[model samples]
Target: MPEMGRLPAGTMGLAFEEAIRRLELRNRLAALFERWGYLPAATPIVDFYDVYREWVNPQHVYRFTDREGDLVVLRSDATLFLARLLGLQLSEISQPLRLWYAEETISHIPSNHPVGDTGFQAGAEYIGLPQGEADWEVIILASEALECLGLQDYRIHLGSRALARVLIEAEGQTWSKDLIRDIHRLSGPCWENLSANLRHQFQCIGEPDQIAQQLGPFASCPEAAFLLQSCDILRSAGLGERLVIDLNEVGLLSYYTGLVFKIYVPGYHEAVVSGGRYDGLLKKFGIEAPSVGFSLQQGLIEVLHGSPEPQAPPAAASGTSWLERLANARRRRAKGERVVL
Candidate 1:
């Protein structure tokens, strides 16, 4: 039998100092999001499994029968839940909604990494904005968030789903999940069979201007044109050196209809942040609007940055009597100095 107090394989328990640091980090991120005009949004931790049945893989989520005999699941994806919620209230809310959330999502899949199934995500969603404007805003926000965490050595791998489709169609090949996966892997037999030009296109990864010059023939296509335009926008905003244009780096989600990106810091195997523009996702809930967002894994961030320095407790109030000490403590607290009696 397992030890009495043992936690599950993919779960985590934080000690006092680490827990305090986590709270501090969450508050700092919340303040950053608020300063950017993103209001906090939350959803139920559990929902009917049917809601996400079509979008997520069964092996990736945790589900069980509820007290009422209905299949329910612990929330696996914050964006999906937020999209479903916003879709139901689209008529009730104003356009260009900016919402942020900090929550923990649990998954069934086990992982060897320190950041496992129960991941804490801090993210923001921009709803009802067109492609270029919305994508630019979210990408800049993501970059700023990394800077807030003191992560200077990071690269944002940018790509476009539409551009991927265009490239595949241009080569007289049908766009399928398998082909996209193979291209992303970049070393499979399917990748080897690809034409030299297409393989070169997938291999092209560099700064925006370099990529634009390299793929001059494909630049005229609408998808590639828009991607380069967005690149120019980011370059103008002083994020040129931080970008890596990878045409094969399409997002993991099928809902992504346009720009997709992942932020990677040096020495980390997994992306610290990932998201994209998913224009068609909200439509599934009967709302028609474009949405873009990104989520950062807080656990991975804590590991990267290390625990913050712990604050020293305030000195205890001195008094002869218990009542006097209590009064002194209250006075110090009122003056904004934390005191113990």
Candidate 2:
């Protein structure tokens, strides 16, 4: 029988070897981000409820009232918090600052969902950069990170919120919050009826050039023209095969101002990686810089990449007892050499 206070569902406790592997993976990812000039950063785990409510679904956040009676939440996403943390200092920094982060985020899933309550996310933000190359840089970095984790069968699905919104606005429809929400959910009769023709074009996902050819007729639409041009650029950079353009795909976060993407592997239905450009988010934080970034779920990597390779057992000292080995280990530690007893 299970104990009265057994570990909760949708949570996990990793053992020694697995824990070490996770640590090593994090170290390698941090090293990679540093090599790309993204300085490491961290933010408080808990933030004001309003911060998350503005950008994400409030129901998914773990919330509580502090002693002062102000509502707070366990952060569901780091990108928004990062913006809030650094926004005030934008005037003091050089243009195009790159920031990287590795942290645990909490989400309260519905009872029927199989997702975990906690997950580790690693990501980077390129601030003060514009849409084209900066967006490509973040997407390529995300793909590279997935490759580093041995997930070769993954595909990146790309979309543009700015394009979608422009198309809707072109129809002269009044901006409807409910309609936007329906679009993101990709469901409901409203979106289905309104997005009929656009959905057909959006579903034409394939190599960038091929999609561009199909979208060329709509070149009169500035957003479509930009999207088509971006596609050619991505193809020139050799990402045509690995990328899928989904015009109907909507941004997961309300703040995603421009291009947005999600990474999907063969076996997992959910995105293992997600990110986008949010040029307008900084303005909300009292800053006016554009930014782009992505978050990789470490837990998903562990699941998809499988267990790390086994390491050989440490050799025992030929002429020393356990006590002598401990003493030797202490001596080595004193000399700055790492020793495992």
- The best candidate by lDDT is 1
User: Which candidate tops TM-score?
Assistant: 1
Residue-level lDDT tens digits of model 1 in 262-311: 99999987899999999888888878788899998877898887656777
The local lDDT score (0 to 100) that residue 246 gets in candidate 2 is: 70
What lDDT score is found at residue 72 in candidate 2? 92
> In model 2, which regions exceed 4 Å deviation?
1-4, 88-93, 175-177, 213-217, 307-313, 317-323, 330-340
Clashes of 2: 0
Q: Between which residue pairs do clashes occur in model 2?
A: none
Per-model TM values vs. the true structure: 0.92, 0.88
- Candidate-wise lDDT, in order: 0.85, 0.78
Query: Please, what are the lDDT tens digits per residue for candidate 2 over residues 236-307?
Result: 676666777876555767788888888888888589999989988887888878888999998888877677
